[model samples]
Target: MPFRRKLLEQTQRDIKRLKNKGHKPTTLLGIFLYGGTLGFLFVVPIVGGAYLGLWLDELIAGYSEHWTLNLILLGIAVGGYNVFRFLRDKT
Candidate 1:
């Protein structure tokens, strides 16, 4: 009886937590959309940084990839931050 009561209390607490957070059941389409959004958020900055760095390197007239690498790293940092912010906001 004590075990059953504890289990029921735990379940009730979980349900309350979900309800308080406005948790929604995920669907296939929703899954796809969320994944796509995450991908876009993560990739766009990298691609943009690559292009901009390439352009700058070309303008510099040198055989170095310093700018491209630096920008790509920066892009990755930005993308990570974006994903972190998105997840934090969702939760």
Candidate 2:
């Protein structure tokens, strides 16, 4: 009986704490906007890297995709890092 009473009191306190925290509810529009921003952040770096790689390849008279491939890979790494940082900070 004593243990059950203590448990009930603890549960009430937890409920009170949660109610006081005042967390805002998430909306559908907020979710969509966040998704769109995340996508844009991810894509911009990759495309920029591809474009830069292509330009570098064109500058040199070589029939090789070395620059393009390297830059694209670099871009992927950068974009992944950006997304990771954004999410970490957001949370």
Candidate 3:
């Protein structure tokens, strides 16, 4: 069998196992919390960073150039590090 096929088979098996385990309320809640946190972890930083950059630009009002870009890059670096850490833990 191909690698993809094996991966799919394993995934189905895991799903079946979870279902067979009775899908307790706590288990479902845990899954939802994990998924929600993952989503927020990925999205919040970019949106918050953009807002912060815009606010900073307004406050400084041309005292220095490229400040917004610098803040955006910092946000990207932080978000990228988080994603890297998540993937590292999975592997």
Candidate 4:
């Protein structure tokens, strides 16, 4: 029937429009994955390094002022290194 043929034609046109629009579901998923990966790569190590230094300082020096200052310096160093690497990385 003509109605069936028109429905098929409309469906084909919709598929072409969708393809041309470049709005696939995978595009959003890829964006999210890339964002999450970059966040994890950049953030997790800095936080983990600070926490590790804090734990080590507490275990070794108890409640001393030197321990507190040294741990803070260690965290600063780690943060500085992270910033430096980020600035240096081109890829």
Cα TM-score per model: 0.73, 0.72, 0.49, 0.42
- Candidate 4 vs. true structure, TM-score: 0.42
The list of candidate 2 runs beyond 4 A from truth reads 1-22
Clashing residue pairs, backbone N/CA/C < 3 A, model 4? none
- The best candidate by TM-score is 1
Residue-by-residue lDDT tens digits, candidate 1, 37-65: 88888888998899988888888876878
Q: Candidate 4: where are CA atoms >4 Å away?
A: 1-26, 62-91
- Deviation in angstroms for 61 in model 1? 1.7
Candidate 2, residues 1-91, lDDT tens digits: the string is 9999999999999999899767768889999999998888888888999999999999988686888899889988888898899999988
Ordered by TM-score, highest first, the candidates read 1, 2, 3, 4
Which structure is stronger by lDDT: 1 or 4?
Answer: 1
lDDT of 3 by residue, 43-81 (tens): 767677777877787888466536567777777777777
RMSD, candidate 1, Å: 7.6
Q: Scored by CA lDDT, what does every candidate get?
A: 0.89, 0.89, 0.76, 0.68
**Measured by TM-score, how close is model 3 to the native structure?**
0.49
Q: Pairs clashing in candidate 1?
A: none
What RMSD, rounded to one decimal, does every model reach? 7.6, 6.7, 10.5, 9.5
